[model samples]
Target chain A: MKLLESGVVSENRKHIISFIILAATLLLVFPLVFDIFRLNLVAKYLSLAFAAVGLVICWGHGGILSLGQGVFWGLGGYCLAAFLKLEAAVNIANEAGTDQIKALTTVGLPDFMDWNQITELPYIWYPFKSFPITLICVLIVPGIVAFIIGLAIFKRRVSGVYFAIITQALCWIMEILFVTRQGWTGGINGITDLRTCLGWDIRTQAAQYTLYFLTAGLLLAVILFSKKILSSKLGQLLVAIRDMEDRVRFSGYDVSNFKIFSFCLAAMISAVGGALFVLNVGFMSPKLVTIAPSIYMVIFCALGGRESLIGVVYGTLIVCFGRTYFSEQFPELWMFLMGGIFIVVTVACPKGLAGLFESHGAKALAFLKKFLKIENLASKDKKEVEA
Target chain B: MSSTDYALYIENLTVSFDGFKAVDDVSIYVEKGTVHVVIGPNGAGKTTLLDLVCGKTKPTAGKIKFDDYDLTTMHEQDIVQAGVGRKFQTPSIYPSLTVFENLEVSYPKGRGVWGALGFKRDQEVIDRIHEVADMIYLSDKLQTPGELLSHGQKQWLEIGMLLIADLQMILLDEPVAGMSVVERKQTADLLRKISQNRSILVIEHDMNFVREIAHRVNVMHQGKVIAEGSMETVEKNEKVIEVYLGH
Candidate 1:
């Protein structure tokens, strides 16, 4: 309580403002920042950033290390894709002047979809036809899923590695569900050939940029929102819960409610990011939502500096950029290099690349001196390299 | 306090872990604005009893009342909101949070999911935090990270946090377990000041520290109150002597 009165908030505000300034400037130049191919790639990176921000809240701030944020991301993507596929079918039927109600959209209803006897579009598919509700549903579907999952896990007082495992299971389960439910989801193939999203010609660069800028804006908003929480009482409480939840509960703060709230918020953020991602990419599949990519998100957070939002984005951009730029150039060696980088980070620069540039890094270095004298001796050489 | 003003009441409340009753059918009353110390030998359930009262542990049986609420049915957080704050034997401050942010977490209701996500300090709460910080002698270290503080300072920060929450009753588990001599003295004085307006249930091992501040002491052995009275009276009780002071 006494802590906030002094100067923490002001310092945090400066960091946030500068970050906004940096993000705004970048958004303005996104068209020219990279070529169209790379820009599309950046769009994917933006989605990854969105998902990582949720991780920061759940794992970094609240101490629930969810290795499965990809579940929420995948859910959002699938919900949006589902509507688009239905809308495409309806549009094709309408264009063909065949409201016969019984005309099949595709072969054998894909798999789970009932094709033969269905003449009219299901009422459930009606709301999705309207862009506004579809938009709302995009956010709601994942939000509801995260809420229910968080309610169950947090209520029982689950924490630490156990919480991480459950979230992983959640992602794995979702991927399996999506893959198995081929009729509804298009299964392993996923719904594709989407030319329009929300009545906009997604093929147009303006539309692409509109979605891109929106993604950037959302990421900024989330960063600011998280910054506020992280600076205030909730942030402190969250950190306390992470360090020692029993102490916080005894302190009368209701650790469970806070955990659930943070978890759900993280999920919602991942959902938003996921929806934006599919809209930009024009496709999504079970492959994108699988455990490998989910764990890759965790690795990005680790590489970026788990505690810093800026770091997460930075990590995503760097790694995603590498996977894109280096894969074609050195396909044989790309994965090996990525794995090596993670090893180097985990074993060597564990403060993450971001810490190297932070002010407290010197103090952190000092703290490390207590255990690692060799690092102390090598600082001058590293500084020369950095310089 | 008068009979009507009793701060907390417990009746045969018991808790068991793996078939062992850690807190066995215990009932006690704490007077308002008094410093009541619970003293017991190690593993005598001193902590488990505090946990039960604070809603950190659910009892296996019985009834406990706080202010006007049923303790057994209450959530840990609502119990906190019901005007009870707790301080653990260990310093529970977030090492990464500054002393001020640590204090802010003690605010009762700012945790609105939306509000909490973008919160700033209210001027009044900030002023109250300053007052408590000065009282606890933590004003100078307001910006210091909790992990950087000495053990004594960390203890003060935790107590300082509970004070800001302004609970009607505070459950302190061994508040002086690891304090240095000077810090211990400061804590004793701080407790005296806090208890002037609120009931304090302090669990402690150091008899001298207990005698310094406790208006009354409750002794426990094997999960039941053996004797209850002032330090001097409990010190002379035959059962208390056999369980704690003797041998």
Candidate 2:
């Protein structure tokens, strides 16, 4: 009994160590391997990977596939963009004298709003002027939206493909609303020319590097927190609810509350990713918050092995990088090729890289162990540290 | 007993789908610490009766009260929280999780989202898990995934899950439907053992198994109880024999 218990504990330790090593590599390795431009792109991809991580738990583990993650991501992105836009507006007014200020704006509106012939800053945009409020909105807006949606849908027992379709429609609705509401959002042009965040001049290469590290650090922390939730009793209930929802209910669990909580948490995580994304990418557009990107987010979770957090990170990086590479090289054929990959991956490996690793990863690791002639990686490191 | 001698009180319950009555104005009472088996032919609305009581199906009229709680207005989870546990016709366990986890999830503590996040499998939980595991003969398969268990073992695991919650009443639908002869006998024994502490409402087709475990038997026909008595008395009931046995 004692030996059996210790074996289980050791296996958990191995997984934890592997996760830490992977996170450390992600955090430190890219800066050494790539220049600022490439690292900035990586940071951008990691930000999307945040939404993918949420998908891993909410859709993969909980069996609630949300095809509208872009709504939350967009919400978060726009919140930050609005804040930066407000900062730029204030800066513009300050630089220009009071005489020029009256000439520059009807009531100190954003340049885009002025260009679109809007005189006054909207009431909603007033709150974004405060950085603290913007930060809070970035997290709270998406969370509250998700909570209400989850409450309405889950309480009525709407789930599976129906839930996915409803969320997909929600993405399209939000996208259209953002595009058509020109004064509120920047419409087709989006909130652009975001030059500074709190007078820090974010366009500089040094700022880019700092943002890259910060995004990496934040992603790593979210992954660890997600990992903790996945290992808890709540995680087991999620699987149980996924397999047999009625059974979980029969066992005295408020199934809808669990669903709501997970959806809300996923939304908040995606919002954080979105805010960081705006910081790295320097823009927030309605185009990024549509059904297509939302579906792409689902595919990111799928290709990464919907079940594996690290697999999701790699999935997002590989797919995003591949898209950029292919689009630049082939342009027209990239879409065809990407579509083919999605179809093949879905058909061939439904569980994604995680499932593949589960079946073959151990064999590959063992083969490497024998070929390298370096005793067990885990114990060897332990022995070295002991010595 | 108190004012209510029954653990489960059903008064003129009726459920209709479209215009057809699935469970018509039927009333049944299950005394505390007793096994009350409902035996009927197919489409006799036996399962629907159990469903209405467990809040899986809402009745068109009448009331279901579990002890002091009016269960007709409660949701399935709330009914369970009110100390009613239900097992479906099929073995509904999380196939990917271990047998221990299958039971651990139903331990009735730390059930909410935040509570479950910090729930640790302390010695008390572990001990209860082991006790239930031994009772269900799943102790050896504690670490084994539920999918690996045989159908009978899976059924036992589901029952063990309900037991871990410390329920006041248990509802079983076709508990021995696919069990082997030996497995059926063991299930009967298990049901008998569990009924010593709480009320059990079983919907069974196998008259022999019902005969083994029933303290009182209610024979139903076409959505209404045709006979209600001890097994010996119900077997001799001409209406029950004709509708069910057809002799």
Candidate 3:
């Protein structure tokens, strides 16, 4: 009892400390350090952190690697973007003169639909018409999609590189669907010109600030919730499954159900990130839903330490910042530079930043302790001579 | 023997890998509360028979009845849940988890995803862990990670995991293959202790260990059981001596 209690207390303390540092950095530090434009960009990157965090749970802990996280993110972004686009259309129609409205061809349809000769809103777009339904779809749509995908794949016992390839293929399919279906989807351009959400001018600096905090807040909540799971028996079982799948199966666990749960949870979390990405950026695009971004999200988790939730957050921030800075400074060389960094980080620190910290951080602490002991000895000698 | 008197009844069990029958037409009955050991030369299909009974591998033609459940048609986990536990040849404990956690994870409760998430480390779980840990002689090493354990301890830890699940029958694949002499003795004692109220089916090569624990012995040669009796009686059998014991 004593051993268990002490273990729980220490574990809780470590989690508490990490949570405080992350919460302060996201909620306090970033807001104070960066201007609104940069802060908005941080919010965008933090939105992707949701996907990284999900990867930590699914790929890192559960040992199920998914390369199509962007699909769920895109689904979420498109869900909210659809709603906002409709609202923007209504706003445009209300503010337009009779001649301008007639020129639009459809009074309250998104401009892309009007341009594509889509006379009426499609049935799929009907759910996005209501904010409450859109909110539910943002979570459920991606959740159900993930659930179905997980059930099909995991139940069949398809895993490892095969699962990763299947998810990558899913991203490719989504990208094509979003690109070719111009009337229903925004087609390559995506659902842009998303000016308002529930009559609130989300484009305003004040709204941007609010969205940034909201994103940070939600991301922190997700981290905490994931921590709860990791500390639970379910988390231990995932680790056990990863180690010896046969043993866990023989231990009477269905195994696939846990895998499905992790995958669905990851998809839902990624979808939430997607919704925030739409709100913060004021647009949702097929570009963000493609293979490259999905792979990049995986790299974010990998580079941060796939196993470390807070480390992935830092990993996302660093990579996103590096991308923005490099792209601005050396547009031609940034891709290579980013690639080089990823290779170096992964090769040098295979456990990612968290592993680096664990190994070197302990050594550094030991050195600090030794240095402090020497200082204390010197102070004691001086005090004795004075006495 | 009447089927009701036996804890495990495997009949006409045959498994083939591309026309190569690993376990062919084997029938064995393990009486309740008894230790049944299958001893054989290498490639004699002793392990395959255990795999068939535990649902790790489906038999090409056979029926394995564990109490009232049809083990042949059940999933590996379902077989386990139906009070059958299997230990692999190697120590297959979770290396990252502590010994206590290894045992705790195998405890019968919270097998589902949500149940696991909400599973509390309650007094009952803790008490059971301690109880099993002591039984396996790993009480002091409960907090140690499984990887840190010596080879013998890892095997015992795996056994403890099976025991904590309150299984009625255990399928052991060479429980003491890599143990030191002392560990082998302790394991012999541990097996005898655990088999008090339950049935144990073991695949073993160590004759002395088998002699120490097996209530009944079956000697197999080329996917067929050649002899069945006590160690002394099996040693006296002509076919067992010619094929396996080789004077």
Model 3 lDDT tens row, A1-387: 666566666656656877798899888898999999999999999999999999999999999999999999999999999999999988888898657797646888899998798999999999999999999999999999999999999999999999999999999999999999999998999989888889999999999999999999999999989988987999999999888999999999999999999999999999999999999998989989989999999999889999999999999999999999999999999999999999999899999998898678645655675677876756554443233
* Residue ranges of candidate 1 with Cα displaced over 4 Å: A1-6, A13-21, A28-30, A90-124, A205-210, A359-387, B1-5, B16-19, B111-120
List the candidate 2 regions with Cα displacement exceeding 4 Å. A1-4, A7-11, A106-108, A375-387, B1-3
- The interface root-mean-square deviations, each candidate in sequence, come to 2.9, 1.3, 0.9
Off by over 4 Å in 3: A366-387
Order candidates by DockQ, high to low. Answer: 3, 2, 1
How far out, in Å, is residue A253 in model 2?
Answer: 1.8
Q: How well does candidate 1 match the true structure in TM-score terms?
A: 0.87
Chain A TM-score compared with the true chain A, each model in order: 0.84, 0.94, 0.93
- What are the per-residue Cα lDDT tens digits for candidate 1 across A1-387? 333432545555547765875585558676676777667778878888888888887787788888888888887887787677766665655666654533545421222365323444445556666677877887888788878888888888777898888877887888888788665566777777666765667878888777777888888888888876676667777888888787777666657778888888888888888887888988788888878878988888888877788778888888898887779789999999888888988777676766655756556655676467777566763453243
Best by DockQ: 3
lDDT of 2 by residue, A1-387 (tens): 353375567757756876887677777788899999899999999999999999988988899999999999999999999999888887888788668688658545788888778887888898898999999999999999999999999999999999999998999899899999888898988999888998999989999999998999999899899988988999888888888999898889999999998899899999999999999988999999989889889989888899888889988988998899889999989988888887888898889977787777666866677678777784565553333
Model 1 achieves a DockQ score of: 0.51
Candidate 2: give its CA RMSD in angstroms.
2.8
lDDT per residue as tens, model 2, B152-220: 999999999999999999999888888999999999999999999998999998888988999998888
- What residue pairs clash in candidate 1, if any at all? A1-B103, A1-B104, A2-B100, A3-B100, A4-B100, A101-A119, A102-A119, A112-A183
lDDT of 3: 0.91
